[model samples]
Target: MRPVVFDGQFGWLHPAAGPHGVVLCYPFGYDALCTYRGMRRLAERLAARGIAVLRFDYPGTGDSAGDASEPGRWRAWIDSITKAVALLRQSTGVERVSLCGLRLGGTLAALAAQQLGDVDGLVLLSPVLSGKNYQRELRAGYRQWLSMPAAMDCTPEPDTDEFVEAYGFRLYREALENLRAVDLRRDAAAPARRVLMLDSLDAARVDALAAHYREQGIEVERRGFDEYSKFMMESLDSEIPRAAFESVENWLAAGSGELATAARDADTHLSADDPQGHAVEAGVTETPVWIDGGRMFGIYCMPHASLVTTGGTPAVLMVNTGAVSRIGNARLGVRFARRLARQGIASLRVDLGGLGDSQPSLDTVTLDALYAQDGANDAACAARWLAARGHPGVVLLGICAGAYVGLYAGSREPAVTGAVLVNLQKFTWRNICDETGKPTVRVAAIGSTRSYLRSMCEPRKWLRVVKGQTGGWPVARELAARCASRLRATLADRIERITGLELGASEERRPFAALDARGVPTRLLYGVLDDGVEELEKYFGVRGARLRRLRRVKVSFREHMDHAILSASAQENVMSYFEDFYRSQFGEQPGAVADEPADSRDAGRSGRRARAAQWLARQARAFRLSGEA
Candidate 1:
């Protein structure tokens, strides 16, 4: 699979083992965010099964060129599918192409297939049968998530037909209007010669839709997809629905005949004014490059005019936040990177090995592994990649798990002179399990404690507690825990002041101390009420005030900034801070100089050897810190 950009969109083109290929249409909004990795896995599975695949981001979303505020996104999404189909056919020389879509993706695929008029096959996995109902679902999901502990307070948008939103993604008036009038069964035609529809447990709509297609003389094989519930979970832990995915693979394989082996997938690279980069927007060109000996992937967003001479401006290196990929939790990485490019600064948003599009080196990659120093090694590799390409320095910035990796990478990589850690939850790992037997993210576990605290402040909830309806033990337990943590921090601070040694809840301070020792400028940002704030207070005092002793390290909290940076306004706030920081660190504007030639062999032996040593060193330190804690 290779990254290809066409029509101002980012897509992956999987070379065909045979002549048949398929275009995968993924879900929209929050569904799109959760199903990203699952969709990528599906495409790989189909490609491995002798069918080529092209999976892409729509123009206004993901790593694509536009913003969600742009109008006509509904048509833009459907048209994106149409263009992807043409690209697949042109590049892979596959005359027989099929469409596989999940949720709203299914709706778009069917519509695209109808537009194409000669699609070979279609696979719809629980597609939205009505736009009206989907809007309701989106609202319900938004409300539910808004109540989660990680959710932050913000002024609410008006409830009107002009907009529909959930989980930081929104549909403009134009898109909402389109969905409002949509009745797939009535408006859409039977899109392919062979159709396979996988429906959810609710079968009424699926049956009716199948019957409607049958009325048009189309053969439809519709079945229950009980695995849907598990498959469409949050990206961090979404299980691949092997049963459903295999069902599609077998269905497509059953009808596939002789297939051509020649592939045009490699030759469709976007040519820019500078042959080295692909122009993704007005002044910025995004080139997808492989790092760590092609074992990891990253998108290099560069300003065409920014010249990188010796000791040039430090490029920004971004890593995955949890398992959501380099696009960031809410596609924040893409927006931020492009904004930086426009400011004459280059940025690389990367997927470390085993996360995002990066190849998983282990048989099973756990969240623990994602937060390990090995991930920091991947970030170090990206920094080196940037360095060899004339960027001798980098400012590593990341959120959540990425923040932890950034701090570790900065500690080891001399080129990383500056770091920005956002909403960092953990500095040390101790594999604790939740009730479900999965290694619990500290943020999730801490959320309950915060919720119980808030309940005491709520009149209704407190009244119930007085009536013995709500348990007091839980509240008392939570308060005791909070008091104990604060006492420990207070004691640790006094001990450190008396002697040069740290104690109690002080493990989280080691990374910052390491960065400070090297005089590496670092900034830490957290939401005022983020779960990580407790850890911050435990280590550095309220709002990280005690960090003044660390001359190079500064911490600040944002108003209503959620841990995930889920909202557009919150994202903008971070971007604004970054821009100010960049200007202060670099200059008002970087003066253009002659471009230096890129390294001949970035993934060469010497580079790999250096990266390996760095990884080993960092991992040793990490192990020591964990042992000490």
Candidate 2:
């Protein structure tokens, strides 16, 4: 995967040996984040078939420079498609080009094709047909969330007169107006020779749109696809849509003779200013690195200007939160990293071994790998790597299971002067049962059982529990287990206090206490009504006072946020917490610079390799220091 800068936006290119190239335009906000890994996988599958492909974040989104605060972003997104098309054509020598867009991206692609009159073919996956209809759908989702049992404890809803915020981003009044105007049924059919539209989960919305295109003399094929919701819904472990991918592959494989000739002719008319007809700031730059002897993969984000100037090595290391990859839930880490870069603070968001692009660790597979056992080891390696590369004051940041890892990893690594733990689900390591029957682990729903217990307070769930469908013994056993667990924790705390040293609860066995002793500036944020909060109280007394009593440990109840931090308003709370933590713990720094092309490749390689070696050495030293070697 090659990261590129086009029209001041960040995108990844998968080069293929085929003559045709495709550009993948993603949907906006949370949908884009949820489907990122799936999209990346789709790109790889296409590339493997000898078709070069490009997947990009629209302007003010993903790893890009601007954000939702920027006005006229709706228009900018439409123009971005044109820029992406040009980029794919120029980067690869492919004579033919096709556009594949999901949701709003599909709409933008059609609009761009109309303007450029260059695209050879189009593929729309779950394309949004009418903006007004989409908005209503979003509003319906919001209402459903509001009525959920968990919403009772959420922070009071924020008042937004001009915008509707959801899934960590908002669409303004003007944007909604733009959406209302985007009725593809009314627009003239794009000049593409063939079009393929996949309806998500048999919503049956695209049939009429495709019929409209067919009436306009356009070749349109519409298919009902069930995996659309599976791909676009949020999950730690995303299941890539094999059927949909295969369909797209089969369609693209059927070639047209005019495709190449038309593509070449269109390339001749392309210019830098052709897309938006204005210059854009190339803000943050990314360098992909392979660490831990090439077993771990990460992307280092630096401000463009920081390339030339020598300064303090300040950076944040963000780990994969659950199975959601390095971008964090809803691309939160990406936005956080770019924001830090803009403030001259470098950050690395890495996929711990066996996740995303990172290779699996020895003795483990993707589905069964134990995250808690080796998370500290991986994070420690990451911290040491940053330290070796001149970043001395590194902060470890993670969410959910990633937070659990950061707590242990940051406690052990001196380079990690601070740590941010968001919505940590559990303190103890629990092995997940898999088909292999070998001890294995991935991101576990540790607090989900507690959530289920809370749900029993409702009469309907209680009825189910009493019925044979749920089994009464299982519920009773769960209650008994919770009581026993709390009893054990209470005894353990008492034993530690009496002996002045943990008896059975050693540093390795007890992460929270160890973290407190290490005196690292730690911030723990949990959702207001998250079941994890009850888990916290169970282990550390009411409000987690056992940990909060420590001078360096801080805890907060984040309002109006789910455990996943899925909403824009919730994300703002997370971002504000981090910004405050950085300022308080590390002080201020200069604004970061944009990309300097000369050093990005070579610098990243040598730096990553050297850091990998140092990390290994550091691990050896740590083992020796602890007498574990």
Q: Who wins the lDDT comparison?
A: 1
Give the worst 10-residue stretch by lDDT in candidate 1.
Answer: 592-601
What is the C-alpha lDDT profile of model 2 across 389-416, one tens digit per residue?
7876788888877888898888778888
Backbone clash tally (model 2): 9
* Model 1 regions lying over 4 Å from their true place: 258-276, 306-311, 361-365, 432-437, 440-445, 448-452, 467-469, 498-501, 504-507, 588-629
Which candidate leads the pack in TM-score? 1
Error of 1 at 99 (Å): 0.5
Superposition TM-score, candidate 2 onto the true structure: 0.77
Question: What tens digits encode model 1's per-residue C-alpha lDDT throughout 1-629?
Answer: 77877888888888876878899887886678777788888887777777899999988888888987887788999999999999998988886889999998888898888888889899999998777788888888878877777774433446777677677788778887787787766667768998999988448988988889899999889988988987777777777788888899899887787544434444443332223467777888888877765678888899867444334688999889887878886678998898888878899999998877878622234676767789888898889888877875798988988898998898888778788888888778765655453675543434624445665678997788779886777557766877687667666666777896756545666777888888777888776567786777666654454565676777666665666888766787678877766666666543211111123123234577765764465346322221100
For all candidates, what are the clash counts? 1, 9
**C-alpha RMSD in Å of predicted model 1 compared with the true structure:** 10.2
The stretch of ten residues in a row with the least summed lDDT in candidate 2 is 589-598
Instruction: Please give the lDDT score at residue 62 for candidate 1.
Output: 85
Model 2, global lDDT: 0.69
CA lDDT for candidate 1: 0.76
Candidate no. 1 TM-score? 0.87
